[model samples]
Target: MSEKWDKESILSLSGAFQTCRILLTAAELDLFTILSDGPKSVEDIARDKSWDERGLRIVMDALAATGFLQKSAEGSYSADETMLKLMAKNGSQSILPLVLHRNRMWESWSKLTEIVKTGSNPNPLGMASRTSEEVQDFIDAMHVVGSVMANRIVESLDLAPFKRMLDVGGASGTYIMAFLRKAPHMKATLFDFPRVVEMGRNRLTQHGFIDRVEIVAGDYTKDELPSGHDLVLLSAIIHSNSRDVNRMLYGKIFRSLDPGGTVLIRDYVLDESRTNPPDGAIFAVNMLCATSAGDSYTLKEIREDLETSGFVSVNLIRNGANMDQLISAEKPR
Candidate 1:
């Protein structure tokens, strides 16, 4: 049965995109830090940012309405607690990069009609004619998006006893470092394209997981995986290809996994019936725009695939927001 309408849903459904734009514009302007020091009048903020006072006031008012800032009757503003913790630069996972990338993404999405009609992705990776710089920018955007999910992903899974963990298609090692922090005994082999491995290595080290994590630079499609890892992980990685490719990769993973080892697969998973969970469904649209044969999979499909690959038992755990449910399957332990 359908649920009753609520004020929250009614407002969010209508104003969500506008709210996102308000937040993104603020992030782009570094408005949080500007206000972080203390309350700032609109005139002062506009002066510092070289923005129009009238426009700034309107924008700030929206932010206040969205709870990112608190506005006083005197027309001054201060950062809210949520903004300081998640929006400000000094926070644990500063969402700045992701916000900026969204700015670029909106531009590309204007061509969604073209992509749909021609069945071609307008993204840099999908655009064969895109310049080298454009490709780098696209990959960089992916990195920023990956960073947003890294911390929680690592914390959600346990890694204490595993000595070696292989991260297949590990983009920036954000997921690896998350795991490494908890499982101090774990050493990681981060496998991905050569350039991505290099870039992610620096990022992982920047987060202080470098000493134990080994970056493996290779195309996962053609390269040989290092054997003897206690655990293998794919974080937000496998949803990029078709079921045939996924099956091939799982087979490879089974062959490479040591006896009694585990394979942990994390991505946007659809529920058993293969519907609802709006985030995963929307992400499938992104996959359509970017990947040739990629789409989100159902948990049932994942479990069946794992079992076919020799995993004894499978467990699924769901995390909130960007870090959705994933499955852990054992290799006949």
Candidate 2:
């Protein structure tokens, strides 16, 4: 390697959680939203939020140090440009929900040691059980993340020949909306859990797509996907399953598609080294802490699994930042 070795980098990694917790705490407190309009003194903010003034000051200073907030000469804090754009509640490109979702992950991550030792998630809820409010938050977080990449992924595809599309485990119909917006002639189906399907209904209706899309409620792992579609999208779903589980789901996807239909997978398609994207390798650890059999997979492994499930002519359509790559395969005619 050409670069010099740095012990400081490794040292910094150990304390990274401190920064994450600080940021999560701020987001949970809706600090960015509170500061969106203008700066506020610690006294003013603490009084409004009913937080201890000393603790609020420490967090605000830490946030300012992290460049998330701007500290005025008068001892007031305001949302910085980045925070205003991505953390404020009504920001144009807000990802506040995603941040909140990370906050939820904290509980699972705290049990990493036990999870690794036992090779299972310690949470009895099994990643699916959540209160109605949490379910809504998770779906909204997915929407926030999907909105950022959906258009780009849709643009990368050639959907001119396909008439109908199915998005399995599609949260809030974000990708379906993207695909439909790109190809107005295409009718689509959004399949997900019942609560997520309900959320999708509201969102699709808000986007004026409820009439064009069929919203179905079912678990992809346990239920047969809706059939008759020429295109199927398994976006951000497979990494949460083992190889056997993925193959089973792929078989289901195969049966759901018409002859010559295509199945597109949007996920972290790792290279042979499994570290080319770097993020994929790191996310594998997240899976370990959160799911029993989930992991990042190499392209070779994915191809083998797809082929075993009756798909052919598999191809990588796009490579993306942070595990958003697209891989496509076709069912034999």
Best by the TM-score measure: 2
lDDT of 2 at 233: 94
TM-score of 1: 0.72
Off by over 4 Å in 1: 1-12, 37-57, 64-67, 70-82, 101-120, 124-161, 203-208, 276-278, 303-323, 330-333
Candidate number achieving the greatest lDDT relative to the actual structure:
2
Residues 185-250, candidate 2: write the lDDT tens digits: 999999988878888999999989999999899988789999999999999989899999999999
User: What lDDT score belongs to each candidate, Candidate 1 first?
Assistant: 0.75, 0.89
- The superposed Cα distance between candidate 2 and the true structure at residue 48, in angstroms, equals 3.6
Tens digits of per-residue lDDT, candidate 1, 1-333, equal: 235789999987877778888887887787887876789999987787689999888999999987889999898999876677667766555665566667656666667678789887745334244455454555565666765466666666666668899989877776777777777777889988776677787887778888888877876677668787989988777788788778778888888888888888888778765555667877777777666777888878888877776777887765444545678888875
